[model samples]
Target: MPQTERPVSMIDPSLLLRPEKVYDDKPIEAFRDYSIDDSDPIKERVRRTYYDMHTNQTVDFVKGKMEKWLKFNHFKSTVKDALIKLNELVDESDPDSDLPNIVHAFQTAERIRQEHPDKEWMHLIGLIHDLGKVMAFYDEPQWCVVGDTFPLGCKWGPSIVYGDDSFKDNPDSYNPKYNTENGIYKPKCGLEQLMMSWGHDEYLYRMLVHNKCKFPKDGLYMIRYHSFYPWHAGGDYKHLLIDSDEEIKQAVLEFNKYDLYTKSAEVPDIEALWPYYEGLIEKYMPGVLEW
Candidate 1:
């Protein structure tokens, strides 16, 4: 496996620079608010996206997606080229910013760059973390390609956005075998043991591994579990965690703050920023990757 040049500190969350309220100057607590508001188009879009995801994303559905995408046979493109394709995507599940996903990618990388000037690997991570959403252009829908992912085949985490109402129609919600807290997993099975709902997080993480990209374990963990709000952000999956997951949780939380808060910040000049990021891509994940 490839390794990052240096270790990213997960011990102190205080080390990461944070603004008072970064999402378009919204309050910190207001960033992820999922309150129902039919009158609001963005809120309604976010609601409908999750509703479609929760209703349709069954164990079978996830398995089928895995069988399809994990093959990595659809296309091959350089990391930079793949990221450029995200210029066409807007995460329907996000109410924070309607800008193309590429802007968010650069916003995320630039913030990480400003905060942790030495961790170039993390800058690349922030840029490409959502690159798995490129699946959207290739026959995949936004519902499964973008959103906060949770463990499937288990009782939905109460902290998941709209978990109370969105999953009511899902067949897995009613299955006796899958409705338990642990579901099909053993106690303390850890994060990797669970079948998290399919999304860009897992896909890009696995892409790194399969392609032998040189990123450290912590950077990879940040990519994989950053969207697992139910565990890292929501505090709902403790019963299934082991001791080491605490370290993983801290790494993810460190990354998550930047991911969530920077959505509405001033957009960075992506053209001038490309040369810097291209060098980082060359260093960490160069060459055309199978996707």
Candidate 2:
């Protein structure tokens, strides 16, 4: 059997970043109701992760954790069972969207489909983009499974919702080797050389890369770093990216606009859209993804 066919390990919560405060107090209603003409709720939620990330993340800490956890497989169970488990995790904290996790995923995908029928790859990307959220249901914490992803090789940005204030608690913040803007990296280096804070985005990206999925560059970028709002949206670490990275950045910029703006109160009937997505899935992915 392939290495990715094994079961993912149950992650330790102690290793995950902790939120400084509960986000439930924030006005997430506009985001939940999808009634906002302005305001980016997805960015807000992702920023909340940054708050925790800055304070709790360390170079050795995240590196050790990823080495220990990333090798594990997440595709041991059926996709249906995985989605069911993911729904349970969503239910624990997501009071806004009462819909099942699968339903929420389908809603996002269908919204993209309706807006751009020509972008069939995007429809599929939206459908499974959050599949990494299943990590929470599999015993991962909110920090490890979801959050704003950023490069580990440079200085944590002040604009990064959880920036320097939080990193005071982390040893790497003081480590000269990691405290610099180019910590552990050269100028204009590609993101592939940079390590991202551990989460579902990296997990799913790795799976797609390994499976050789024939997705558009934009779709692949969305999967790899949809949680990386700090660099993409906030312009926080643009200095670290090379020319090739900049081009890829431009491609995904369009994808992010659709992802953040397309949420709605009405849920998409998955049964109605499954055939179209399933065909796309079969076209791009193999009979079974490794994880």
lDDT of 1 by residue, 1-291 (tens): 111221221111222233564356666645655666789899789889989998999999989989998889999999988888899899999867899999999999989999999999999999999999999999888999998889988888877777557788999999999999899989899888889899999998888898999999999999998888767766777888899999998899888888988987898899999999999988988888898
The residue pairs found clashing in candidate 2 are 50-162, 51-162, 55-166
In the range 79-157, model 2's lDDT, one tens digit per residue, is 3445456555552223245456677677777777777898888888888887877767566657667656777757875
What local lDDT score does residue 253 receive in model 1, on the 0 to 100 scale?
84
Error of 1 at 203 (Å): 0.9
| Candidate that would win on TM-score | 1
Give the Å shift of residue 164 in candidate 2.
2.4
Which 10 successive residues of model 2 have the least lDDT summed? Answer: 9-18
